[model samples]
Target: MTQNIRVVVVGGGYAGVMAANRLTQRDDVAVTLINPRPDFVHRIRLHQLVGGTGDAVVGYRDILADRVALVVDTASRIDTTGRTVALANGAAVGYDYLIYAVGSGSADPSVPGAAEYAHTMASLEEAQRLRSVLDTTPTTAMVTVVGAGATGIEVAAELAAEGRAVTLVCGKVLHPYLHPRTRRRFAKRLAKLGVSIIDGPDARVTGVSRDAVRLADGRELPSTVTIWTAGFSVPDLAARSGLTTDAAGRLLTDETLTSIDDDRIVAAGDSAAPSNLPLRMSCQAANPLGAHAADTVLARITGGQPTTIAIGFFGQCVSLGHGAATVQLASKNDIAKAFAVGGFLGAKIKRDSFPGLIEHLAHEAHQPGSYTWKFRDDTRRQRLQTLAER
Candidate 1:
């Protein structure tokens, strides 16, 4: 006799999937997930995809809840007033509540010739394109990886491990999120693997050509294939749809993850900027943000008020090929600590994190509330909540 509540979640990444799975806690709620790709992209292993060592996709059926309907289509626009989403396939999906989790993609580089010549590997399609290009080029081609973040380091190491002539064109210092001690350890490991790293005050990329990359120091490196992994850029769906957004284009939300314009609309994952203070854009934060987004919607539906959002931060893990990794230790506040772990243990933890991500979604799919209980860090949450208030 009760009316079914309809909830729509966009983007099937970690946050979207987790939110969809947890919404299954109520039989009266009908959940729908909209994603452009049929297969869920295991983002952490995207470097492996480019290196041809592993697949970066997993079937949605493997992790999504049975109760959630999967719609494979690109969302062109969101009609908040109508509570409907327009799809590229000329279809529309209606929702009583909407969760915006359309994660992020490689940033559009501004350096002259970089956009025209450089390649990026932020999505499955981009990775596959780079792989195809790699296949055609000579083995000795000078491969330049621009950027020193986790993606850049992983890509550079993966190629070097495969015996490719690889150069890491760090814009500045390497692994800026890591401590100086850990950065040194990573540099040594990379050097041992034969990766040419160019990093200094004037190491920023200035331009890119068909066969060379120019640096600010007036040096030009012969680069047959230039890959850009500098930063992430979110989709402008919210802005295109006339919704309020931060300077970075993320949907601006309050502590409850609800949009400033509409309580019926909430955001999570990389595209969510909460209280102008979003957690780092990573799968680690996405999983918990997803779960909490669902909780807010459920609370509103049942006449319970949604509380503040609090997510913990675990430092970064950069897999240096199959041989090693740098699991940077960090405080709950997400600062990298001096102590680090790697070699075999870091490799083990990084390997497990791949399936570990899927396991969280599967657990919530089979048993709705288990994710929040098993993975929630209460002490860290309290700390983050206090930070939000201030």
Candidate 2:
């Protein structure tokens, strides 16, 4: 009898879970997924969690494959040479092949007192903590949200719709990734909810205190609760484990998503820097990467050649509260296009997508090889070829 292949996946986000489920295609493969939290966090709905609009957690049993083992522990280090992962609780998990999908979290705020006072909503605990804080805060108190990315916009709109005195401090242009027309549409919706929009270079946060936040323009806003959604920072597991990593600390892999140092180690999701040209860090990109990573590992296990990754994006959907949303159309390469969708239709699509995403995961759990995605991006292909020529 042939020995079964043990593939250990780190991180239980979309990428890790999908990869684990897809690996169940072969009875000879055993998948073990290790996550810090026992439950899965619907990361796109984190803003809803913070604003009391929705819960952002799902039990792993609801979405994870029964054949896959779920380990709830933080990965402290990866012993690449020994093919083992060190856990925070002083345990070691050995594997025949390892998948690195350790996703990202809100970047630690360097603004004075921001880290100590301002709250983040990147994880379950953080969102719960922020929700608790907001619960105790008086409605009359000012809620200041820093950053104007998709997260910040959603957060600001969600709170403002709930009658909070919300001010969105855009470090620069509002919805920088959206086309100018879509940005205007979002601005109109936010205004309708009485959200105060403060954009421009001078709107950047310079400092944060218990009851106030200072701006770059020398104005201090009376902010009872400050929220930061500025940027993302990936866990340093790959770098600390002596693996080859890019400047941003993501594991460096070839086009096949295999590690440069070890063929048995594969990478995907936000923490994967394949060819040092990673896709945008979002669930949109992660799902396909997860499927592709499992394909790579399965190919190697079967003594077959793995194909290069070819991922693309549709666009971005930003929820503007329960009543409204905006879908920014984009090309496969993620450039915001001129046409956009807004209003009730947009909100409906956004509402259906979360449950739809969970159903996709559950479907894959029940039937391993059933889920497949459309993948063909001539733009991405041309860009990679150009990079190679240089």
Candidate 3:
């Protein structure tokens, strides 16, 4: 009898779950998925969680493959030489192949007192806590949302729509990923919703107090609550295990999604930096990366060559409160395009797709190789290659 291949996937985020589900296609492989939480966090809807409009989570049973063994535990370290992962619960899981899909979280900002006083919507717990804070806050309480990225914009809009006095402190520019015309429309919507937009060189947050926020330009904003959505930082498990990683601590992989240091180790999602050219950290990329990682493992097992990574880009969708959004069009390489869909149409896209994301995952679980996306653009591919060479 052939020995069964043991594939251990760490982190139960979108990428890890997709990889686990896809790996179940083969009978000869035993896939074990490790996650700290019992439920899957719909990170894209975390702003809704903060706004009290959504829960931002789905049970693993709803999306994960029934055949994939679930291990609820936290990974402390990866012993690559020993091919074992040490768990926080004092157990270790040995694997013939490892998939690193540990996703990202709220970055530790340099601003003083922000870590202690500010709220971040990086995880389900954080979102829940923010919700609780919002529950107690007066409708007219001054709430400052730092950063004008997707999370900040969404949270500010949602809260402002609920009658909270919301201020959006844009670090440098508002919706930098958006075209100027779409940005103008988005800004108008926010203003119409009673959200104050602070943009300029001095818009950067410098400090957070118990009830206030200070900007670089000596502007002190009276804030009863502060929400930080500035940047993201990944877990340090890869770096702690001494694996080769980028400056941000994401595991370095080749085009095939296998770790450069160890062929036995594969990487996907926000935790993976392939060829030093990682796609944007979004579900748009994570699902594909996860599917590709599983394909690579299966290819190796069947003595087949794995395909090189080729990911195309789609545009960004930003929810401006509940009934409005901005869908910025993009080229295959994710460059901003002039065309955009806004208002009710954009809101419909956001609302319709939020629930469909899980359904899409469930479909992948049932069909294994059912997930697919846009092919990579040649120009972008060549440009990335040039960057890698340099």
Query: TM-score for all predictions?
Result: 0.96, 0.97, 0.97
> Higher-lDDT candidate among 2 and 3?
2
Give the least accurate 10-residue stretch of model 3, judged by summed lDDT: 372-381
Worst 10 residues of 1 by lDDT: 373-382
lDDT per residue as tens, model 2, 106-129: 898999999998999887888899
CA-only RMSD, every prediction? 2.0, 1.2, 1.3
Question: Model 2, which residues run further than 4 Å from truth?
Answer: 1-3, 388-390
What tens-digit string does per-residue lDDT give for candidate 1 at 133-221? 99898878899999999999999999999889999988889979999999999999999899999999999999999999999989999
For 314-372, candidate 3 gives per-residue lDDT tens digits of 78888898777888889878888998888678889888879878987899889888888
Q: lDDT (0-100) at residue 15 of candidate 3?
A: 94
- Predictions in order: lDDT: 0.91, 0.90, 0.89
* Number of backbone collisions per candidate: 0, 0, 0
As a TM-score, model 1 comes out at: 0.96
